[model samples]
Target chain A: MKNAYLNFAQMITGIMVAVLLFIHIAVQKLGVILSFLGFKISDPLAFNSMMERARQGLWAGIYICLLAFGLFHALNGLRNILLETGLSPAKMRTLTWLIIIFGLIFFALGTYVPLVLLTT
Target chain B: MADNRPRENSLGIAGWVWAGNYTLERYLYLLHRVTGLGLILFGIFHLTATTIFRVQGEAVWNATMEFLNNPVFMVGEFLVVTAFAFHALNGLRLILQELGFTLGKPVPPIYPFKDAIRRKRLWTLVTLAAVMVLVVFFFIDFAAGGPG
Candidate 1:
């Protein structure tokens, strides 16, 4: 992708990450308060509750989305950092491709957790 | 005659910590990078750990959770939460500035010059202050609402 497109993607994915992370953390940590507020699950950290959340298709989908967005934004940011450290053009290009591959692997592994439970 | 030898005064990675002349904005830039790097590392570890936990099944997951249920981990989690608050708020401010929302219209340089940087400086401070407040709130929530 062009630098501009990558930057735009960074901004958009960043926004999504902030929103999703807020939901994920808030729901996980504040499960008791949320449950009192009629969220149903009182202990989100409990193994059963964690599995329950993962099993929900909507939550699983959101988890996958978060994984993808977080990985892309972070790896792109990593690429930018690496480029700024002053590499040769060829080195920078190679590094960028490396990061892309690394990000894809991480995303696959990250999503597998949620997908595993969701399938079964 | 322009003598263009390789500049000897390059600050390098040290510049990320200390440049001779740096304003709050510069320091904020440094903080942004530091927190971003830290968060990225934390995120990767988090994802990897969860993936492993999922693979190992509930017994291992609960055992790992039990192991991590400690004061040190709690403190570390608080720091991560604080870092996230700062990074997210600062990132939003940066996005707005990039989009020209936090900036003023361009004006020709007069005897007394002014531009978007002034407004942006204030926006940075405001954003930093907001991060502080948000972090405090998160702390309270974390303290009051333990692993639930």
Candidate 2:
């Protein structure tokens, strides 16, 4: 049952990451592509401008959703890799909990900064 | 020999690479694992850096960006792009396989193991080619000092 749940989570998160990452990269590159075409999009490298854009409704939502999916996908993928190393069942359980805690901490940090930046 | 049994001593790093006969499929699996690990590491650094921008203010964020402008860091960024290309493309392939989009329907258990590459070789090649193109594009863009 645990293995089944893990596989299901991996499949779902993997799909989410694949789709969201493409969108994220495309948006990042769109700034450059527009500049090359002489349309004068906002400077992609300008941190302030980027943050300002992130504060907007659509970009902010995209960023937050990306963060949520990315954190879960990455940490879960890492945990799967570690499990392949043939740890004892007890060790596996401990590792699972450790990764879960680590994911929560980092997810909190990741989500907090984006929300704060978006609001303020 | 298509063996499903897990090898007891195949848990080591060298074992992972050397234990199995080298094949395109094995190489793809290895590359996927390595690139996934690389992306995870880079993601950690990125998250921390972005969080620093919020917590430490503009001056520190600018300083961090300046520090990242070093040539060595630029090379690292290139590698990160390469990893991203492979990881993302192969991840798409994996997701497709999981959802039963590409691999053909199940067959009788005469052999009990079907080669995925044989079943979806076209997709494997297409994803690999796509990754190569993207990695080359990113490399050129980075070399030209474009925003990553």
Candidate 3:
């Protein structure tokens, strides 16, 4: 059961990573187009305003979801890597728990981060 | 370079220096580490800039904008974007492996232990194609003078 849960988590993380890659590529290409059109959107005011609206958009929500998936995925991956090393089972279990806790904390921070930035 | 003879067959500690083993798992692991570090560096820069913008107001923000507009900074942005793209794509591969999403294994298979990892190479090719497309776009942006 534990193994199954771990596998499921890993898979979800993998899929999210794949999708996020595509989004990143598409966004950068869009940036190139915007730049070519002489629409310099890097200044704080313009960039912030644009991102603010995007942040409130459905896509932004999707990004936040990816952030959560990525945080957990990386943490879990790290845990697995360590486990494959020479660590003892008890230590591995403890480390795994710690990693999970850290993942949760980071996930919370990820969501709070953009909102906090947008606000203050 | 006379005494720098290559070690035959035996992979010493430094063998993993440029990504130790060439195994699938090792490749993914190294890529993950590279991307993770890249993103973390960018994240720090991002948050630090935001903090400065909040505290120091427009003067600092304007200076930052000027600095970021420099060609060197623009190149750095290109690298960061590439790092992000690679990390995200490779991350998906790791997720698929972890999930046991083999090619032919249907959910609740009669023969559960069938080797479903058949199209592994195909998935890798797809990822490579995606990365190549991004690199092309990145070059175009860099050539046309990238973001500030």
Among all candidates shown, the one with the greatest DockQ:
2
Candidate 3 deviant stretches above 4 angstroms: A20-25, A34-60, A97-105, A116-120, B1-29, B40-73, B91-126
Candidate 2 segments whose C-alpha is farther than 4 A from its true place: A29-31, A34-40, B1-11, B104-116
lDDT tens readout by residue for model 3, B1-148: 3432223434433444453336554665667776776765675465456444534544666677667677687778778777876776666665555556635335564654433443466677677678778677777867865433
List residue ranges in candidate 1 displaced over 4 A.
A31-41, B1-9, B105-115
Which residue pairs in candidate 2 collide?
none
Task: Kindly report the root-mean-square deviation of model 1 from the true structure over all alpha carbons.
Answer: 3.8
Quick one: best lDDT, which candidate?
1
lDDT of 2 at A2: 62
Task: Give per-model CA RMSD.
Answer: 3.8, 4.3, 9.0
- Preferred candidate (TM-score higher): 1 or 2: 1
lDDT of 1 by residue, A56-76 (tens): 999998889989988988888
lDDT of 1: 0.80
* TM-score, cand. 1 vs. native: 0.89
Q: How does each model score on TM-score?
A: 0.89, 0.86, 0.63
Candidate 2 chain A: minimum summed lDDT over ten consecutive residues — where? A25-34
iRMS for model 1? 3.8
Better of 1 and 3 by lDDT: 1
Candidate 2 versus the native: TM-score? 0.86
DockQ winner between candidates 1 and 2: 2
Of candidate 1 chain A, the 10-residue stretch with the lowest lDDT total is A28-37
DockQ of each: 0.43, 0.46, 0.16
